[model samples]
Target: MYRKQLFLLSLLLMLLQTAAFAQNNKLRVEPSFWWTGMKDSNLQLMLHGNNISTMQPVFNYAGVEVKDVVKVNSPNYLFLNLNISGAKPGKFNIQLKQGNKTVHRYSYELKQRAAGSANRQGFTSSDVMYLITPDRFANGNPKNDSVKDMADKLNRNDRSGRHGGDIAGIIQNLDYIKDMGFTALWVNPVLENDQPKVSYHGYSTTDYYKVDPRFGSNEEYLELSKQAKQRDIKLVMDMVLNHIGSKHWWMDDLPTEDWLNFQDEYKTTNHRREAIQDPHASEYDYQLQTEGWFVESMPDLNQENELLATYLIQNTLWWIEYADLGGIRMDTYSYPDPEFMSEWTRRVMDEYPNFNIVGEEWSLNPAIVSYWQRGKKNYNGYVSYLPSLMDFPVQNAMVEALRDDEKSWDTGWLKLYNTLATDFLYPEPENLVVFPDNHDMDRIYTQLNQDADLTKQAIAYILTTRGIPQLYYGTEILMHNSEKGDHGIIRTDFPGGWSGDKVNAFTGKGLTKEQLDMQQYMKKLLNWRKDAKVIHTGKLTHYAPYKGVYVYFRHNGPEKVMVILNKNELPYELELEKFAPQLQGVKQTTDVISGKAYNLNQSKLALPIKAPLILELK
Candidate 1:
């Protein structure tokens, strides 16, 4: 019995030693894998482990070499600069050692690139974007609604809480989206937010390399891309490069002091957008605007750090290649350092020449937005390779114009006309995203004062305008925010997204007559516009608003579409002679909405009150 006890004690000691060694050798390598034949041969691997900086990395793979090992201020982190110039698609072992004693061994993989990945086409003006808040869209998989490891659990009652929407829901509803005539799907950030509260919106990224488990797995996100592509629908990912959640794993052990902006002394951003363009703007203001934390809960990233920049760039490329994204909607474009933004855009564009990236610069001034487009000639001599920008100026103008009752120099339709006139500021004006409203603003229906006619007019304007058009989810059924600017209310649950909801938008169950009509009208407009190439890449011309009517024409070589918006309470008679330049040879026209034929050669045109007439002329 004593001999057996001694043997048991020896076994326990051996097990304890193994546990200690495992704990000491625990290592984390980011970008777990990479691809061969990339445009850039250089790859920077971020390694994190206990006292990893004290170890030497050994690579015995052919065509792969560790050019340099950089040890930062933190002993727990090591940056390995590797050159994979002639490396083929295969796996190789990288072992970390402390003076010939192997501490940890990792098998790194180099994946094969997909065919034509470098030349994938991105979303364009011809595609209509459907902006969806995933949490509010649909709950397809209830099993993942509450994850044990995730901080925020499912709370359907809380307006700002997670509501259990996952990529499975999106994959399930691709037909509904495709049938709705939206050629592109722009889902708000699906990355891991993993915060304790307010994690539904997904802006506060906790893990750059992971998809939020509460929503779905990384494989599920990739499945969405594949399924969406099969239906001829493009996927545009919303990316936040400015800041991350305070609860990020790195917060406990930062790689370096400079990995974040304003590390020690906490400072909030000034939100002075003009500082980026104001030539005489003080360096202090510029630094505050670009480097300051967005909010106390959000820690700003420091793109100025070369290692951090490389990591961010690699993360973006990995997502693009892994998920097969069609485009990227970069959040808070102007909030980052301009130099870094330029370099980031240039590098991504270099790899995928046909890919599109639209930056969000929430400035009402055209000059501020124009400065970020790829080919803009800024007076300050600043250059940006960003291909597109959110047209906030046009959106704000459209809302204000629809709400005004009277026509004036700066009010009513003139606001929209003048806003479009500023297109000269953009090198590719048609690339801008024109929208009636977005997730951040009140619904277009509410902005139009609940007037159905005005709502239809706004939709027609954006769809026919000289830019890519984006529609917020549930806009077809005229969803509203009774709380006005309340973001949570504005991004409310889609009526039929849940299983037991009273109304089902998918099936058109329990809907009012007005809602049904609006949905049908939107369906027709979008389906018709899908094949309208004139409106896609046409030349636009507008005549000044007379009385309460505004008229515009979108024309190509042989196709022409004339849009007339009558905002007056009473019917108006318009003289066709005034539009002889566009209508002289046209005799017959069809109203796209009403399906009624009109003789354009007649002396006067009769227009119904508050009706938007989109006529295709021959």
Candidate 2:
């Protein structure tokens, strides 16, 4: 038991030591010296000092008092955990004296502790992530919009340029987001982007260690996480390890020539994601795609370089520790060097055991996306430690189904029903991050042909089904592109983001009734799901598609939820006893969105055409 206790104490000390390195990076203190935040009055203070093999604490003539001391495991790695004595509640310079010469003086500031609340620092699969591009979202702080000498000047007038939607703007809207029932929020890369044109998207990272001053200071970000935590909202920080903005500070002074991977000129990715996981892939295709730069403006990172690897690893660890991020959404995850990428993910998992991270591998092939998931034996024998992957296979399936045939199992709407059938490919099907439309794709409502009923049904399924659900911002109102393929129009400004604006989803002002219902329905389902443990941690069982109606079940031991997705224009009567035997005892249920009653046992009720239904057994 004593040995076990020592092991835990040693582990805690190691974490403190790792964090201490970032404090100032100039300290050569002995490893034996450590501090613990344990509140027990009886604490241990292990010490190692120069010029003396051993030491003891003794009080002086001044009302100064010293606590107990204990020898620890390491001669150099000492522990310092002491009981409070006649010390005042302020900054004090404590002197460590020896026989002839006193070598150490430590300045410590002691303050009253907080109420000791628990921090919600990690996320689970049930969270629905809402992605936002800071500059494109809203401009709440215009004061810091443009700096006089900044190379990347602010351009509100420029459609592709930066509009100052600072962190302050995001903080001001957490209430609105929480009210909308989103469990997690993922903003685009908020690090400093010193790039010249089109830095507005916040993806061109200039500095990984610091938050962009154009948004707000690091302190403001911390406060945002703190506030979001109170509402049980998890913050998923978007990170890009593959590349950095060309105008980054590192460009002026690189730590090494090999800081970037095979980078010299701007080149587009081969866009052959299949080559990375294909058994018959060519070596030339692999090297050109993974090792190449996105463009002349974005330099690919050299994960193979040891120094570069450590720098990035340390930088990621710093953000997770500093902001207490719930999870990470790694942008362009497949573009990095595969082996070192595994090491980077493994180190993060080693440091944060309970945390979850998702990588964006945009592919319609289940095998391709599944290859990145943890514990998969890829075609190349590559093993990854990544926890979750975006369910792009299902996303594409959904889009194809919306456009093509719905009945045939080989393609179209049947493709979506068939895609979930391959859940065996994923290590944890429940751990995937599911979404309708994100910042890059067309809006969900638009993709569903702007049918309010279909949009509502998609929300019902995404909220109650397995995996973490990420709702794109402005999705509730069916925001879409005025033109078919313009991404800029797809990510339009939220109406009330600017002054003298008309529509505001926050207040339901000037919105159509259908739009309001869309908002309410999403908020209703998500907020209700916030407390549904069965839905969050349940085992999912899906049935094959029948006449364009898809059915699935989420069961946790005995409690279960039956979700039905009907895309047909005609209402289909499901015989409860036939097809899906699991729906046997299901009777009365409360439809999450409308609070309406549904009776499924020994009865035939017409399921709304092209809508979804969540029926919980009463």
Return the top candidate by TM-score.
1
lDDT of 2 by residue, 1-618 (tens): 999999999999999987775442322222112122212222233233432224433333222345434343223323344555443345555445555544455555443333321132456866778888777666678887876656667766666767677788888888898887787889887888877777767778987767788887788888888888888788889999999998886675454557676655556778787778777889988877788888878888888876467557756765775677888999988989888889988988876667788999998888889998898877678999999999998877776766666645575557877788888898887889888888888888888788787777677767776788888888888787767666666767776676566887768899999888878778788888888788999888877777777788888877877788877787588656553466665667876656789876565667877788787764
Question: Cα miss at 328, model 1 (Å)?
Answer: 0.2
Query: What would the TM-scores of all predictions be?
Result: 0.97, 0.80
Error of 1 at 537 (Å): 0.8
**Cα lDDT for residue 533, candidate 1:** 94
lDDT of 1 at 448: 83
Candidate 1 regions exceeding 4 Å error are 1-24
* Model 2 misplaced regions, further than 4 Å: 1-121, 264-267, 407-412
Predicted structure 2: lDDT: 0.73
For 146-181, candidate 1 gives per-residue lDDT tens digits of 988777999988888888888898899999999989
Q: What is the lDDT of residue 84 in candidate 1?
A: 93
